[model samples]
Target: GAGVSQTPSNKVTEKGKYVELRCDPISGHTALYWYRQSLGQGPEFLIYFQGTGAADDSGLPNDRFFAVRPEGSVSTLKIQRTERGDSAVYLCASSSLGLAGGSQETQYFGPGTRLLVL
Candidate 1:
């Protein structure tokens, strides 16, 4: 089985540009999550999907950011008008059901997509 993987480990762009980060979740996983981590800070939840529906998207910062999981497997995070503040490591994780009750359901993280907005 393939573990979660993200494309473009590092991205550099100027302000006001747009970028799309991709994530490939583990096979047979039903839950996928996106998180952003800035320097010296913990990862912040962005959005999560269960099957083909967005189970929780409250963590999305603004309308400039959007994500989709049309097939309930691969997901993509798109950022519009990229700003310096948006420069951070975009992380993706997937789990069996995203439940914390059991250790077997813990989220496994990808290497991460690092974005640099100048």
Candidate 2:
């Protein structure tokens, strides 16, 4: 169906508040990923999901950041006690389970959700 879609393209909130970012990935794609990027910095991996379970979550900064994909389709990133440094563009991407070295099973990126914590 769709490539990938994120809701609330922009978010503005005060520090210490909570925020939830949503991501809808392409149908039939079993792999999903989340990333965060600040000014002048490259996207840093936050989490990766294979199917409905999180295959890896080492990139999360602390206990404040969390994500879930219960149904294996839509995913959400939750942040509690948000900080000014937490402000960044949250990106989502999807790719097929396996990619050949010479093939282009590259991950498809979605328009990020820019979160600004004032």
Q: Please state every model's RMSD to the true fold in angstroms.
A: 2.1, 2.2
TM-score of 2: 0.93
Candidate 1 structure quality by residue, lDDT tens digits, 1-118: 7799999899999999999999999998888999999999999999989888898999999999999999999999999999999999999999886455323688989999999999
- Residue 9, candidate 2: how far off, in angstroms? 0.1
How many clashes in candidate 1? 0
- CA lDDT, candidate 1, residue 13: 97
For candidate 2, the 10 contiguous residues with the lowest summed lDDT are 96-105
TM-score of each prediction = 0.93, 0.93
| Residue pairs with backbone overlap in model 2 | none
User: How would you encode candidate 2's per-residue C-alpha lDDT over 63-111 as one tens digit per residue?
Assistant: 9999999999999999999999999999999887665522257788899
Clashing pairs in 1: none
Off by over 4 Å in 2: 99-104
lDDT of 1: 0.93
Please give the lDDT score at residue 105 for candidate 1. Answer: 83
The lDDT of each candidate is 0.93, 0.92
